[model samples]
Target: MVHKGNCHTQAVCAVATHLPARIHVILKEDRAYELRDLEGRPISKKDAKALIQREYTVPEEIRQRTRGHKKRRRRKEGYIRSQIRGLVTALQASRFA
Candidate 1:
C-alpha cells in the first residue's frame, strides 16, 4: 500500500494481487498504526506489511496474454513426436506398397 500524502484526507493506494477485482481492498484494519503527517492527520499505512503481497495470478495472466515464443521443452517434445510419426507413416506406406 502506498501513501497519498498529496490528498487532504488520510488515504493510501492499496495494490492487491490474486484479487477478483483489478483494484481491491487489501487487508485493511481500523487502527492508527502510522505516524501523522505535517497536517497532524495520521499516515495511512497498512497494519501488516505482509497484508499486500504480489499475486501469483498476475504473472500467470501475463504469460497467458503474451504469445511471443513457444516453450523450448514443449517444442522439443513436439519435434520428437513429429519425427516418430513421420517414421511410422513412412513404414506404413512401404508395407502397403
Candidate 2:
C-alpha cells in the first residue's frame, strides 16, 4: 500500500540508481536553498547555485487566482504542496538507522 505522501519517494529512489552521486536540495519558503538529504541538513551555498543551473527538470509554477469564484484551484494547490512536503519528509527518513 502506497501512501500519497511518499509518492515522490518512489520516483526519486528509482532514479537514484541511475543518477550520479549528485547532491539534492530543495527551495524553502524563505527563498533559500537547503540540502534535501535524510536529515534536512544545512549545506554550503557555494555549489548550490551550480546544481540549480545544471538541473535538467524544472517544476511547474503554481499560483492562486484571486479573481476566481471557485476555490478548487486553491484547495488543489494546498493539497499539492502538502503532498510535496510529505514526500520530502519521507525522503529524509533513515531506512537503515
Candidate 3:
C-alpha cells in the first residue's frame, strides 16, 4: 500500500509478481502513485516532491466503470462456457435417445 499523508492508499496497479525485491521497488516508486498531468512527462525531483504533498482523489465514476467492465468480462466468459456445455449435453442425449 502507498502511504500518503495519514491515509494508506491501496495500490491499484496490477502487478503479477511475488518477488520481494521487485515488490519493494514498485511500492517505493512515488511516480506510480502520483496522478500525472495530461502531458505525462517525467518531472524533476523538486516537482515530484510538490506533487506528493498535494492531496488527490480518484473520481467515483471511474472506479465504478472499472468494476463494471471486470464483471461484464467474467459474465461473458461464463456464458460462453455454459453454451458449450449445453451443446455437448444435447449432443449426448440425442445420440442415446
Candidate 4:
C-alpha cells in the first residue's frame, strides 16, 4: 500500500507472508527514508525536492491539453526522404565548392 501524507512525505509499505515456509517480511520504504537518490548518491531533502521539481514538473500548456488530442502530426516518409536528399545535395555542394 502507498501512504501519502504530504508532498514531501510519501511512503510505500508492503507486507509479505509465506505460509508454507513461515516467512514474513514487512517492508516500509519512504522517499525521504533514505538520504540517497535513485542514483545512490547522497542528497539533501531540499536538493531532492529541487531535482524532483526539475524532472517531474509538467508545463502548464501541456497540462491544459485535452486527453487524446493530437498535438503534432507525424512526418511522412516522402517528406523525410526529400529532406534527407536536400541535406545530401547541400553537403555535396559545400564539399565541391
Measured by lDDT, the strongest candidate is 3
Report every candidate's CA lDDT.
0.47, 0.52, 0.61, 0.53
**21-48 per-residue lDDT for model 3 (tens digits):** 6657768884363434437776777776
Say which candidate scores most in TM-score: 3
Of the pair 2 and 4, which is ahead by TM-score?
Answer: 4
TM per candidate: 0.33, 0.27, 0.40, 0.33
Model 1 lDDT-worst window of ten: 1-10
| Candidates by lDDT, descending order | 3, 4, 2, 1
Model 4 lDDT, full chain set: 0.53
lDDT measured at residue 73 in model 1 versus the true structure, 0 to 100: 64
Write the residue-wise lDDT of candidate 2 on 60-92 in tens digits.
321122224247778889999999999888887
lDDT of 4 by residue, 1-97 (tens): 1122222222111222333232222133322334557788989999899877776565445444522243332345567889999999999999999
Instruction: Give the per-residue Cα lDDT of candidate 1 at 81.
Output: 100
RMSD (CA, angstroms), candidate 2: 20.7
